[model samples]
Target chain A: MKFIIQRDRLVHSVQEVMKAVTSRTTIPILTGIKINTTTEGITLTGSDSDISIQSFIPAEEDGNEIVEVQTSGDIVLNARFFSEIVKKLPMDTVEIEVQTNFQTIIRSGKAEFNLNGLDPEEYPHLPIIEEANLFKLPTDLLKTLIRQTVFAVSTSETRPILTGVNLKVENDELTCIATDSHRLAMRTANIESKINGTYSVVIPGKSLNELSKILDDTNELIEIVITENQVLFKAKNLLFFSRLLEGNYPDTSRLIPTDSKTDVIVKTKELLQAIDRASLLAKENRNNVVKLLTHDGGVIEVSSNTPEVGKVVEEIVAEAIEGEELKISFSAKFVMDALKALEGTDIKISFTGAMRPFVICPLHDDRMLQLILPVRTY
Target chain B: MKFIIQRDRLVHSVQEVMKAVTSRTTIPILTGIKINTTTEGITLTGSDSDISIQSFIPAEEDGNEIVEVQTSGDIVLNARFFSEIVKKLPMDTVEIEVQTNFQTIIRSGKAEFNLNGLDPEEYPHLPIIEEANLFKLPTDLLKTLIRQTVFAVSTSETRPILTGVNLKVENDELTCIATDSHRLAMRTANIESKINGTYSVVIPGKSLNELSKILDDTNELIEIVITENQVLFKAKNLLFFSRLLEGNYPDTSRLIPTDSKTDVIVKTKELLQAIDRASLLAKENRNNVVKLLTHDGGVIEVSSNTPEVGKVVEEIVAEAIEGEELKISFSAKFVMDALKALEGTDIKISFTGAMRPFVICPLHDDRMLQLILPVRTY
Candidate 1:
């Protein structure tokens, strides 16, 4: 393969594909990025066992030449070194030439690099998915849905199913839920779908995390294709493929409380910062527990005590307090993470007794909710 | 002890003292920072076994009240926790009160912290240094001198003495030199000293690095006091004391050759970037070696080859080339570091032979020189 491409264009696509290249992969070809040149454009592919990413750069876009192809062929180059070389090159254009034995020569400005390349035939092919089950959604909305729920996924390997986020679509409504047994986060959004079918799948939170970084807040639409064991997300000239977990996700809707003994509406930033300060001393303990107590006159106290370290007490004025007074203890990090994911000036928190789970959501917004199981403090 | 101090002032002093605080220390008191309140001001001190730093915040500075002293006393609190608490406090001014039995209470806004403190008597006392060999230099100059030579200090523990920068004062001239036996960096500056004596000492490179960070580029004079076993640097309200390494420093003056077989002058930035790109492939090997070949027509070729990986070659234009043509190989990182240290637009390189050491200095400045040993490629 012989092609001369714009340095900036090649660098951007290389970085996007490199996200799926894992250094610890058992398959040697998985560690290398596959490069192919055609008459129309150049394609770069990188994959691990769990996820794969492919990006294409067209020869010409918007009346500007992006790539000049001399020949069409394919080769696999070391992803680590190839990206580094392109990033540090001085010229505005880079020329890549592949020989009969897969010897790649890359030249830019006065600098030239001869890299050893592997045969492209050894690289595995990407699995093909049918477009019949594809649905369209805005990239911004998908990114928001992932950010609001992905952090609550279980990080432990004991339960592999809990490591994924359960995504469900029904009646033109899409919902995403993630839980780690101790806490749960759920977000629901309306979709303008014409199809009359329900789809449910569990995607590993790791894949969504990387996908969110690659996506921008543009109003462009992204097509999501789903099958029994694989899912594909296509946007612009990029394709993202991830494997679906092989198990049923736990039903966490029943864990959320319906009634509460006390409810309070407070400024979100104030409450988040107070809990953050309280966690300074609480972090010495394994649970990182912080207690919240509601008092008269709409005052909320956040406190934590570690015997060997110290104790911290913070008071925040709530906008309104109703029902009975209550005290509850929960992980400070979990509460802070939930508050950060929520977007509103004021947040409403409901406590369903000291030992039961409590729910918090943006004030007057029922589309998102976070539930946490309170720890019993003797 | 009871006092109210501005948050900005407290944070600044805490960061200054934190430079001397090491996380792993055999002495428990060394891990804590001592706080002392007097009628005139407030003092904060932190120390490890090798160095100690103390900062004082006066009651008023520049006609602005910085500290309000309600009571006078001393106590030592864990450096790690105190810095965190002060950083997160919301109020502009923080109030600290010490109760009986070494209990400390810190209050800012509606946030309160109760921390356990140790007796101040257990903290080590700062050693007194006589002003017999006192001199003064601009803070900016000292910082520059440290930056130009400190990177050559040996990081390995094989030779403890080589891990320090040798400082010498003779005949109103101050000279600093550092080397790891492979490369040496030397900087010299004239000082208007009142003392007619000579002094030479080796200060730990780690201590100098921290000192450089804390010292700003202000033209204020820094008072340096030298003793048999310790050196004290006093600047304004801050006092920094470091222990001297006990060993004889090697004589590196003989290593710098006076004559050269080949000489080349080139732009510093161009040469640095070329070597940086050459190192991309050279780094695959253990030595990170890059070869430089000076050819006719003032063209310098920088190249590196790794058998299993690939090869890279770069050409840089030289302003002038004279004497015999030379080809020599050296570590890319070492050459780049030396280039970054020297302050000039152009640099002159003098090569003795293929196997001998070479010297590089700024084109117009003779105040600093860097010598690097060439590698054998046969």
Candidate 2:
């Protein structure tokens, strides 16, 4: 493969594909990014066993020559070192040439790097998904959905399916849910779809996070294609593909309570600060538990006590309070996560009792909700 | 201690002192910060046996009240938790009151933290240094001197003294040297001292690093006091004390080469970039060895080869060259560190031979010098 490309364009494409390059050396070819030159343009692909990313540099962009290909061939080079060299190269244009023996030479300005390239045929090919089941969503909305639910996914690998965020779609509405049994986060958004379809899939939270990082917050629409075992996200000239988890996602609908005996509405910032202060003391305890007590008339108190770290208590004025007064204890980390996922200025929390689970949702929106199970504090 | 201190002032003092607080709980009291309130001001001190930092929040600043002292007393609170609370408190002023039985109540706005304070008598006392043997240096200069040599200190505690930077003062010049046996860095500056006596002391690199971070880039003069077994740095109302390592530091003067068979002058930036590029491939090898070949004319060739990672060769045009042509290989990390410590745009390198030691110094100054031994490559 031989090509002369603009340094900025090559660097940008290399960075996008480099994200999927495997750090592990079990599959040596997986650590390299495959570069393919053709009459159309040049494509760079990087992949591990779980996910793959491909970025295409068109021959021309905005009437400026981006890629000039002398021959069409393929070679795989080390992803990390190549990306670093391109970033540090002190020139506006770079020349890349691959020999018959797979010796890749990259030159920009006075700096030239000769990297031992692997046969592109040895690198795993990205699974192709038919475009029949594709749907479009705004990049900003997709990023927001990922951020709100991804943090709540189970980090432990005990239940492999729980490590992914469950995506459910019906009609034109998309809902994402993530939970670790201790706490849960859910977000729902409306998107423009070509047809009414009901589908469910679990995409690894880590893969979604990486994909979100690569997707800029532009008005551009991302086309998503779902196959039996893999899902593809295509935006602009970038294609991100991830394999779906092969286990059944646990049913979480019954875990969310349908009713509550007490409800309290408080300012998000005030509650966040109070919980934060209480967490300072709670962090010293084994369970990291923080207690919340709601009294008559819109008064809420957050407190935590540790024998070695002492105690902390803070009062927050609630917007409104209804039903019976109650007290409950839960993990400060779980509560903080639930509070962060909330979007509105004021949040309404519903409690069934001290021993049961409680629901946290925006003051007026019911589409997004978080549930946290209270710990039995003696 | 009973006082109402401005939240910002209290937070700033807490942050400075907390740097010395021990993260390990082996010494319980060392993990706590001692707060003392008197008619003059409020003092916060934290110590971890090796290092101590004390920051005083005066009762008033610039004719404005900063702390209101209602009672004179002292208490020790958990440093980490207290600092976190103070930083997140949503109040302009914080009220602190010590109750009977070592119970302390800290209130700011609606947030109240009741911490279990320890008896002030249990806290370690700061060493009192005599003013007879003292010197004054600009804060910025002191920070710069520390940064230039600290990175070369040995991290292994096998030789306790090698983990510290050796400070030697003779006549009006103050020189600091640090070496891990493989490489050495030395920096010298002129300072004003009250006494003409020669002084040598080894200060722990960790403590100096923390002290450097707290010292701002200002023209303020910092007072240095050398006691029997401790060194104290006083800047304004802040006192930083570090215990001296109880051993003799090895002499590194003989390691620096006096004369050379080859001498070369090159732009610091150009050489740095060449070393960086060569290091990319060299890093894949265990030793991270990069070779530099100097020709008769002023041309220097940088190269590195890793069987699995390919090879890199780059040429840098040197300003001047002398002596026979030679090739030498050394750790890329050492060269990078020396380059980073250098201040001038142009650098002068003197090489004894291909197998001998070399010295790198700024082109127009002798205030700082770095020496590295060549590595044998087969």
Candidate 3:
């Protein structure tokens, strides 16, 4: 491949593709990024067996010449060193040329780098999915949906299926759910599509996280193509492919409570800060549990105690309280994560009892809810 | 102990003292911070065998009350947990009280934390250093002197004395020199003192690093007291104590060449960037060597070659070249570090041959100089 490309454009494309490149991959070729140059533009691809990402830079962008190609070819270079070199090159344009014996030369200003390249033909082929069941949504909305639920996915490998987020679409509404048995996060949004029947799939949480990081927070529409064993996300000049987890996701609707014995609406920031301070001492304990108690006059008490370290107690004034008074103990980290995900000024927390799971949602917003199981404390 | 202290003041003092506190200390009490409340102020101390740091928050500073003392006592609390709690406390004023059985209660706003405290008697006593031969220097100058030479200290423990910076005082001039046998960094500054004789000691690089971090960039005079085996630095409300390394430091004066076969003056920043880019590929090799060749014209070539990877060559414009043309290779990392430490718009580099050690100094300043040994390359 022989091409001269703008330094900034090459740096951005290399970074985007590197999201799928794993440093410790068992396959030697997977540690390298494949660069293919054609008459249209230059394409970079990176894969780690689970997911693959490809980024393209056209010859011209916005009436500005981005790349000048002299020949069409393909080669793979070590992603880590190549990315670092590209970032530190001291020139506006970088020239890359591929010679015989897989030798690649990169020149920028007075600095030139020659990196050993591997045969691109040995790299794994990307699986293609049909565009029949494609759905479109704003890139920002998809990023938000991933962020709101990805953290709740099970990090433990004991239950492999639970390590992925379940996506279900019905009647033009798409719902994303992630749970680790102790807590669950659910978010629903409307997507534009013409599917004739309901569609469901489970995507690995790690793939979603990497995708979200590479996706910009723009209003540009992203087309998502889904199949039985694979999924593809297409943006302006990026294509992301992820393998679907082969298993059935557990039904989590029953874990969320439909009625609440106690409900209180409080300013999110105040309650978050109070719980944060109360959890400082509890952090040294194994469970890191903090207790919340509702009292008369719209007062809430948050407390945690560790016999060897110390104990912390905090009293906060709630905006309003309804239903019966209650007390619940749960993981401080779980509650903090849920509160951080539910982006709003005010939040309403509902409790069924002291031992059952409770749900928290943004005030006046019914599209998203976070549920946490309480810990039994003597 | 009973006192109410401002949170910001407490946080700053705790951070300053934490530099001496190590989590993996064998002495249990050494891992805790000793908090002593007196009628005048509150004192916080942390020690880790090699060094001790104490910060005092007086009752008032600049006519603003920083501490309100209700009683006088002392207690030791776990440095790790206490620092975390103090950082996250949600109030401007924090109330601390010690009750029976070393139980400590810290109250701030509506939140309260009770932590288990150790008996103050178990904590080690601070060593007393006589202030007979005390010297004074600006805090900023001291910090700069430390930064200029500390990076050259040997990190390997094979020769323990090489891991320290040698400080020699003669004729009211304090000179600091550090070398790892391959390179040397020396910085000298004049100080006001009442001593009549010369004094010298080796201070651990780690201790100097920590001390410099806590010292702000102000012109405040710092009192430095030198003892036979210990050194004490006292600022307005802070006292830092460090033990001296017990060994003879090697003489580094012979390592810096007196004459040069080739001398070149170049912009510090431009040469630094060129070397940085040339080192990108060289970093993958074990030696990490970059070659510099001076041409008849005012041009210098910087390049590196790795057979398996590729090669990079760059020609840079030198401000002036007055000596014989020569070619030399050296560790890119060492050259970059020396360049980073030298502060000036231009630098003068003198080379005595292809193999002899060279010297680098600021264009017009003689306070600091860096010497580097060139690597022999085929």
The candidate 1 chain A region of ten consecutive residues with least summed lDDT is A190-199
True contacts kept of each: 0.91, 0.80, 0.88
**Residue pairs in candidate 3 whose N, alpha carbon or C atoms collide under 3 angstroms:** none
Candidate 3: interface RMSD equals 1.4
**Which model, 1 or 3, shows the larger DockQ?**
1
Q: Which residue pairs show backbone clashes in model 1?
A: none
DockQ score for candidate 2: 0.76
TM-score of 2: 0.97
Q: What lDDT would each prediction earn against the true structure?
A: 0.93, 0.89, 0.92
Per-candidate DockQ vs. reference: 0.86, 0.76, 0.76
Chain A only: list TM-scores of all candidates.
0.98, 0.97, 0.98
Chain B, per-candidate TM-score: 0.98, 0.98, 0.98
i-RMS values of the candidates, in order? 0.9, 1.1, 1.4
Runs of candidate 1 exceeding 4 Å displacement = none
Model 2 agreement with the true structure over A1-378: per-residue lDDT tens digits: 789999988899999998887687689888888999997889999888788999999998889788999989999888888888888776799999998689999887777888888988888777867888788889998998899899999999999899999998787888999998888999998877764477799999989999988999987889888888899999999999999998788899999999999999999889988998899888867668999998776899999998866898888889998998899999988888889878989999999999989999999999889999999995
Candidate number with greatest DockQ: 1
Q: Can you write out model 1's per-residue Cα lDDT over A1-378, one digit (the tens) per residue?
A: 899999999999999999999899999988899999999999999999789999999999999999999999999999998999999998999999997678899999999999989889999999998888677789999999999999999999899999999999887788999999999999998765554589889999999999999988987888888889988999999999999988999878788888888999999999999999999999888789999999999999999999777899989999999998888899999999999999899999998788998899999899999998888784
Candidate 1 local lDDT, B307-353, one digit each (tens): 77889998999999889989999989999999999999999999988
Per-candidate TM vs. native?
0.98, 0.97, 0.97
In model 2, the clashing pairs are none
